[model samples]
Target: MGIKEFMISFIFTSILLSILFIPTLLTKSFAGIRPSSFSGHPQASPFPVSFAYLISASKGDLESLKRTLCALYHPANYYLLHLDLEASHEERLSLLKFVSAHPIFSQVGNVWIVEKSNLVTYRGPTMLANTLHAMAMLLKTCKWDWFINLSASDYPLVTQDDLIHAFSSLPRDLSFIQHSSHLGWKMNKRAKPIIIDPGLYNLKKSELMWVTKHRTVPTAFKLYTGSAWMVLSRSFAEFCVVGWDNLPRTLLLYYTNFISSPEGYFQTVICNSKDFKNTTVNHDLHYIAWDSPPKQHPISLGLKDYRRLILSFAPFARKFKKDDPVLDKIDREILRRNDGQFTYGGWCSERGESNATCTGFGRHENSGVLRPGAGSRRLKALIVKLLSMRNFKRKQCR
Candidate 1:
C-alpha cells in the first residue's frame, strides 16, 4: 500500500481500538453492587469483586506469559499484559496476535496489551515506572475493586472464580501489601546508594550505574520496604496515580535513584499517607519461598513444593521455570485447567471428554458467573487469618 493509504488505515485502526478496547476495560464490579456494600460474609450473595491485573514479561517469555494469562483469565477481570522492550519485535507481535485471536478473549473483550513497550531494568526505578504506567492506564480505563500486579514467572494457585469468591467478603478499601518499617540491612545499602537506570531514558538497555557519593536518609518520611507484588484497592491505586496529595509524586522523584524502587515506592507512599495507612494488611497474598540463607531471588517452585503450595492456600505462587511440570500439576489439581485450555469457571459450559475442561466462550453480560472450588475455601481461610483482629490491626505501616 502507498504511504497515504497506510497512514489513513493506521488512523482508522487507532480510532477503532479507542472505541472497542477502552470501554471494554470498564469491567463490572461486584456483580453491580457498590463496593462499600460488599463487606462481610456474602457467600450466598453471588456477587464477586472485580480485579484489574497488570502482568509483565521480559525477553523469551512469550510461552510463560501466555500460560500465566490463560490461567488467570476470567470474564469478570480486566487484564493488561506487557512484554518489555527487550523482547524481539516478532515475540511482541506474536503475543499481540495471541491475545487478539484467542476465541475467549475476543468474545470477552477483557484482555489488552501495552503495545508501546517500556525498557525496564531490574532493581531500578524503571521497573516501578513501568508498573505506574500500567496503573495509570488501568485507572483511567477500568472500574475494579482491586489492582494486582504480577510477572510472567508467576502463576495462580487458585482459579479466578475462587479468587473472586474469596475476596468478595473482604472490605474493598483494604490493600494487601507486605510491608515493614524495620529496614534492617536495607537502610544503609538501599537507602544510601545512588543508582541510575538507563532504561528510563535511553532506548537501548544497559547496566545500572552507581554514583560514588552517598546520601543521608531523609527525615521527611520514614523508609519502608517490602515485597514488590501487591493487591491494591482502586482508591489507593487512584491516590498513587493521581498524586493529588503530592506524596506519591514526591516519592516518585525520591525513588528515582533508589535500589529496587518497586519494593519500596508504594510501601513508602502508602505508609506515609495517613488516609490509607490504616487500610494496610501486611500480606502480599503470594506464596514465595526463598532459599536457605536466602539469595536475592526466591527459589523456583517445583513438584516438591506442591504440598506446601496447597497448604499455604495463597492465591498465587511465583518464580516457576517456563513450562515446568509443577505448573501442569497446579493446572490439573488446583486450577482445573487442561493443556491449552482456559481455566474453568461457572460462566462457561465445559467441553471435551466428561466435560472436564472449561471453554470460556461467552461474556457475563455484567453479572458474574462464578464456580468456586476447593481453592475458594482454602483462600477464604487465609483471608480470615490475614484479616483477623490479631493479624490485621497490628501490622499497619509497621
Candidate 2:
C-alpha cells in the first residue's frame, strides 16, 4: 500500500476506536437528576448493627484484594475473605497470613479466612455456591444486620461509617438488589437452556456444557434476574440459608446445575416467596456500564468514567482495571484514603505521619461521631430516589 493510503487508514481506524471507547469514561450523571435526602438522622449504629462481608478473590488478585480489604475494613463488621481455588495454594496461604498478621484484625477478631476454597468458573454457578457457603458460615458464627457481597475488583465509594450512618435509618428487612423481570431474548438463550458447570464436580477450570434438549420455564414461580452482586438483609439471608421454609433449599438444588445461577437464584427465591417479596429494594447499588451491544462481561471502568461514576452517587462500582488511576482518584477524593491506607472514618482515631487514616483505633462510643462527606450526600440522594414514591414499590421484583 502507498504511504498516503496507510496514513489515511490508520487515522480513520484511530478515530473510530476513540469514538467507540471514549464516552464510557467521559459522560457525567444523567442531566438534571437530583434525589431527595433523609439526612438528619444521628450517626450511630442505631441498634448495634453489624455487617457480614463476603469478599471473593481470585488468581493474581492478591494485591488488589489486600488493598481493598484494608480500605473496607471495619472493627464492627464481620469479614470472610475467600481465595478461589483457581488461585494457587501459595497465594491463598499468603493472603491468610496477611490477614492473620494484621494487628487490628487480630484484636477485632471479626475476620475469618475460608480455609477450604471452592473452585469457581467465571460466570458459572460455582460463584453462587461460594456466596451461599459464606452466608451459611456467617449465619453460624455471628449475628449481623446485613450481608454484603463484594469482589476484589470492586471498591467502596463511601466510608463504612457513611454506609452505616445511612443504613441506620432504614428498616432491617430491606434487601438492596437490582433486578428486572424483562427477560427479553435471554429467555430463549439462557432460561430454557440446560448447562452443566464442570466446576461443580471437576478440579479443572472448564466451560459449562450444554445439553441438546431445552426445558420449559418453571410453572411454580416467576423468574427474575439481575446483577449478581447484592446487599442482603440478615433476616432474609437466614431465610435463604436456614429457613423454616423449604423453597430456598428446593431452589438451591434446582439451581445447582443452572448456568449463571448468581444472576437468577436469589431473584427467583425472593420473588417466589410471598413473605420476602415485599422486603425487596430492587437496586444493585453498583455503577456499571456496558457496551452498545452489551456483552457477557461489562466494560472495565477506566479514567474516563470518573465523571459519571461520581455523579451516579452509587456507593460502589465494579470491574475496574487493576491499578487504574481512577481508583487512586477515588481513594483520594471520595473515600478520603491514601494509597495503602484505610478510608478515613469515625472509628479511625489516631493520626499517622501524613494524617489520621485509621492508624490506630479504639471503640468509638459517641453516637454523634458521624462525619459524612460529599460521597455520603451523593449516596443519600440516590437512596432517597430509590425509596421515593415514584420508585420505591413500583419497580420491585417486577
Per-prediction TM-score: 0.86, 0.85
lDDT (Cα atoms) of all candidates against the true structure: 0.80, 0.74
Q: Which ten residues in a row have the lowest lDDT in candidate 1?
A: 29-38
Looking at model 2, report the run of 10 residues with the lowest lDDT sum. 29-38
**RMSD list, candidates in order:** 9.5, 14.7
lDDT of 2 by residue, 1-398 (tens): 34465345434423322232222322221111111121112123333456788889889998888888887876567788888888997887788778777766665566778776778888677788778778876766666788999999998888887787778788999999878889887788888876666676678899876666777988887888888999999888978866779787667756655668899889989988999988888899899889988889888998899898988888888888789899998888777787766778766653222354665463552333555567777888889999998998898878
State in Å the error of residue 294, model 2.
Answer: 1.0
Task: Give the Cα RMSD of candidate 1.
Answer: 9.5
lDDT of 1 at 283: 92
Candidate 1 on 1-398: residue-level lDDT in tens?
34465345434423322232232343431111122222222232344678889999999999999999889887677788888889998998888778777776766566788867778888877788778778777776656789999999999999888999888888899999999989888988899977767676678889887766678999999899999999999999888877569787677767877899899989999999989999999999899999787678999999999999999989999989999999999988777788888887776643222344777543543355677889999999998988899988888897
